[model samples]
Target: MHISEGVLSPPVLITGAAITLVGTWIGLKNTKAQQVPLMAVLTSTFFVASLIHVPLGPSSVHLVLNGLVGILLGFGAFPSILIALLLQALFFQFGGIIVLGANTANMALPAVIVYLLFKKLCISEKRRNRIIGGFLSGSISIILSGTMVALCLFFTGSNFNHAAKTVLIAHVPIMIIEGIITALVVDFIFRVKPEMLLGTEH
Candidate 1:
């Protein structure tokens, strides 16, 4: 769901950049020292996950796992996504530098929201609820991010009907896979490294 440069108007790009910068700064400032290693690992995962493409119709998409990252890293998801996207741009040029703000906002904001939701669910003190929360968060995050992307395309004056249909259709199966993967991963982490999850104080 990477937006290439020159696809959006200059005004939209500038506004997105400003918002991204401010959000990223706040995320960085809020991150705790103990969360650094987990953030690093999640960021690496985000970077590597982009390389695994799944074919859908006439197009292909990659797993982002932003929901899982957000659940684990909380507000730290912003910086993790930003770093991962920067790496992707520098190494593979998956997204243009000019569109970095839009891309980051689209992907990372949903992650933050999902993280908050997951945190609340986990507060129930039940393993099943935590797992379900993670699962729902993962699924919801994909939808939110995907919808934002569609909105971006629409606002940027792309063929909204075509773009929305393409994105929605392509993302359906991918979202299911993402949710399952995220749930499994979250369960595994809870068993072996629960501290990695945000608000899980060991």
Candidate 2:
């Protein structure tokens, strides 16, 4: 679901860049020294997860684990996504530098939104609720990201039919896998390192 450079208009790309910069700044401001190690690990996990692609019809989908990142990192999701995407672009060529802002914003915004929704679930104190919230957050993150990508394509005057269909269909299986994985990971973290999540003031 990575949007390569030259696919979007300059105006759209500039807007995305501006927004991503602001988001990154906010995320950096919220990041704490103690969370650096966890952020590094989670960012690495996000990067590696993208490599495990599942073929779906004419397209391929990959697990993002963005929801789990959001749950664990809170507002720090912005920088986590920015760093992960940058690494992917530089090392894997998953996306281009010119389109980094749009791609990062597309993926990261959903994670941030999922974090907000999960926060509202009032599951901060309950184990089962946290697991369920993590699953739901992960599932919704893919859906939101896919939809945003479709909209971006449409706004850029691309033929939305094929792109939309491909994204929607390809994401279904990945979404399910992400939800299950996120739940399991969240549960594990809750058992072993609940403080990582609970420590987030947001």
For all candidates in order, the CA lDDT equals 0.79, 0.80
> Per-residue CA lDDT of candidate 2, range 1-202, in tens?
8888788878778877887888888888997787788788988988888778866567776778888777777778889999999988888787799899988888888888888888545245677787788788888898888887877777777666687668777677778878877887777777787666677444
lDDT by residue for model 1 over 1-202, one digit each (tens)?
A: 8888888777778777886788788888988788678678878988888788867667776778989878877777888998999988898888888899988988889998987777677434577886788778778889888887877777777667688668766666778778877777787777776666535564
Note the residue pairs that clash in candidate 2: none
* Regions of model 2 farther than 4 Å from truth: 53-61, 120-123, 200-202
Q: What is the lDDT of residue 109 in candidate 1?
A: 90
